[model samples]
Target: MLNDRYDNPLTTRSQSARDAYVEGVDSILSANGDGIGLLQGAVQADDSFALAHAALARALQISARGAEAVAAITKARALAAGISGRERGHINMLGHLIDGDGALAYAAALDHLAAFPRDALIAQPLTGVFGLIGFSGLSGREAEQLAFLAQLAPHYGEDWWFGTQFAFAQIEVGQADRALQTIECALERNPCSAHGAHVRAHIHYERGETEAGLAYLGEWRRDYQRRGVLYCHISWHVALWMLERGDAAAAWRIIDDCVRPGKVWGPPLNVLTDTASFLHRAELMGGAPQPERWREVSEFARQLFPKPGIAFADVHAALAHAMSGETDALAKLIAEPVGPAGEVVAALAQVFAAFARQDWTESIALLAPVMATHERIGGSRAQRDLLEFSLVAALLKAGRPDDARLTLISRRPKKVGARAVAGL
Candidate 1:
């Protein structure tokens, strides 16, 4: 029955409906809320459907109901038992979702590939898992997984679904130029591919090409609108770039657009938190404390934490407190070991503390390692670039122009908008 949903010559009507359902599923995955109501109706009509269950599980997961997602996936697995081919690949996707370890999931995906080699659906999740682990620079297993993906690309064709994964791996490995080329190639092959456009935007944004990055977002927005999909994170990326460029007003505009009331498939809190953080930072940069927004952002940050541990939320919380001049609050917040995100927040808090004390040397020393580590891990490139710019400002204040120049030169193509370049 599950196999009939994907491929069955005899059940023409069933096959047509299933094809439309799969398209709806992909649209929902890409952040289309309009399809969810339709999908809900389709699932109700076919209760024994594994594909419907999988799609519902994905939709629920994006909506932030993890427990409900687990239930849906359980039903999917049971119904998928007699399925084969592409339908089995969908089951493997549920496995990837259940397993938190990206490297392990990628390995398991490869084992599934032995039985279904030519399935593009299988390649999509495998690529995402590899990119997740690869971006963290976790050696050995991540490297092997990425290499396997790169090898798989040529066999599948240059325009394969894994192309963006290869580009992201290149970026993580510090080959930004190559990453740009790879994405450009992918876009050339399929101009309408949102995946290619998204990757290209990241490449440009990370390299400090703010105007180019924004243009890519425009392109992506057109493509997304045409397809009735949404890129929720793109607004945050644009806001961060504007903030880094010292355009507080422009940044706030992006934030406003992000949180404007709308029907959305995923949890709207992600963008809400981003808008709050950007507002808090912009207020601080403008030399006024936004007390109300500070509280709002902090509350959202708290809500965002205690889950998969969003690194940005922790750093934003610490920064919000620091901007409000709540030194004690900042100190207490950074004390928790929230993994990579906490480390970043702690480093920033130390800088803010030193700055408050008018101790320039201490501030420079505190920010050095934080900047280095974030640059390596592909942390928000916009944020890292701005931090490097701030480091130069701190160094100049400390009368250390030589060190500032060295730091400026090390970031290369990303040095364009950096305040450090002015010091050079």
Candidate 2:
């Protein structure tokens, strides 16, 4: 029996196969290196490596290679019969996710971890805000995510991958000071870590350190390959900071090059949501989001997400549809929303629609109450700023400057530097 880097027993007897599996897992976890490529190499070196096949499927699914991922997972299930219990459970959980069974996947992850805590691959899906637990649409999700990572912390001290995730969990729960230090530790251990750089970017954004966030992330990402899992998202942070600093030109350039639809390599969820969010935020700042840009994003959303299940992406899709005058698409989401957070997503859709209609009063009324529970929409607080800024813009537009100022003061005290809203 060979052991992985995490000291978990592997059924693969080949050292080379084991080595590739270890590197592949590290790559996907950090969003650096060639995770899928290396996982394929692992399967090639040992065709009977059930864990490697399962892991390959996970990486493929993350990259949004749906058909290939299905094929890989099918192979993994076929090979699962003779493997260890840990291997069987690992495949099962990932199978659940690939089958679009988030609830089952989440439950299976917990069950798997109770026995094999060091199964970092099995645990990866449970770590981040975009993970199963974060998008579970449950209330107190931020606190829930932090507590889940906290429980797994002792098992993974000083591990760079786990450190970045733990640090982000803390950041989302309003623990900026503590998160800064943890992310620093992770970055120190793995300077090329894409996830490490991303978590640090979120910390800077949370604390209203726009200049520092831009300077640090801008330089760090210069060397990151564009195809890396987090490249478009990290670039979104840079564009956000540029907009904050009143450099709308630079921000739009970043959007055109990296964050826009068909412009960069990224998950469709990220491509659509980031494009819609950035364009709307730019619009709030009084920058013109061209008609063509809105149409492209709306069409992209329609093609990729004709129906909605993921609330985070759904709300953004609704924004694109509303802005592009895709009334039929918008009406469908409003009429029949489905998911735990479907209603929240529907309300957000209505908010965007009203904003598009320039009916500020209606938008404000619809948006205000949802702010209390917008965490159900999923995504980090920084990512959710689209809603916060949307509310501010609505207040400002509705001839309510005082209310807008009060909203900023009560909700985002530290982030009150930039003036993106009209008449504020």
Taking the candidates one at a time, how many backbone clashes does each contain?
Answer: 0, 0
Clashing pairs in 1: none
Q: Write the per-residue lDDT of candidate 2 for residues 5-81, one digit (tens) a residue.
A: 88988888888999999999999889998899999999999999988998899999999998999999999999987
Candidate 1 wrong stretches, greater than 4 Å:
1-13, 28-45, 85-96, 99-107, 113-131, 134-148, 172-177, 188-193, 206-208, 219-230, 240-248, 259-292, 325-333, 338-359, 375-380, 418-424
Provide the global lDDT of candidate 2 against the true structure: 0.90
Q: Tens-digit lDDT track for model 1 on 1-424? A: 3232224221113544465566656444334434555556556666666666776776665566678777877887887666555565656665576544555656666776665554444455545321344334432433554576676765556652456667765665557898888877767766655556666777876676877777667556644642233355566666666665667677666565554224232244444445544554353344355666665555555555534234444555565555556666677756764543455666776776675565779988898777655532323354344466666656866888777667667765465453323334
Candidates in order, TM-scores: namely 0.74, 0.98
Output the TM-score of candidate 2: 0.98
Model 1, position 22, has a per-residue lDDT of 63
What is candidate 1's TM-score against the reference? 0.74
Error of 2 at 25 (Å): 0.6
